[model samples]
Target: MTTQRTITVDQARQIVFDAYTTGLPQAAAAKLLTGQATQAWVTSEYAALRRRGIPAMSGQGSLFDPAAEN
Candidate 1:
């Protein structure tokens, strides 16, 4: 026999990324996003956001290149 558990969709997504994705493990990513280095975290966060209906940025641009980014 087995017991079932309940979890929200958002929670499930978080778990999915935690279980998958490469570079900067989940805890560090979360901390970086929620705490310091918000902009740096945006790259990975946006990737996750894309999975949940958020669209990716258009065109090619370097975060380091202000002109290209715009």
Candidate 2:
């Protein structure tokens, strides 16, 4: 029998952030972050990340934040 480890949303966000900083494509990074290959899952995870203030890319602020554009 095998047991799966469940991570917190913050931990998942960190994983995605680190993956992006390493230059991994979003799709690949999402897969690594979520352990799933479905586009819907990837999209949902990205949206959640955005809502939590994780930038979509390196050296940039959250796109959903208006102040980030300043």
On lDDT, the candidate that comes out on top is 2
Model 2, poorest ten-residue lDDT window? 55-64
Global local distance difference test of model 1:
0.47
Q: In candidate 1, what are the lDDT values of residues 14-41, reduced to their tens digit?
A: 6434433433445555553343334444
What TM-scores do the predictions have? 0.28, 0.47
lDDT of each residue in 1-70, candidate 2, tens digit only: 9676777767776766666544466788676755434456556766676688755565344545688767
How high a TM-score does candidate 2 get? 0.47
Model 1 residue runs over 4 Å out of place are 22-70
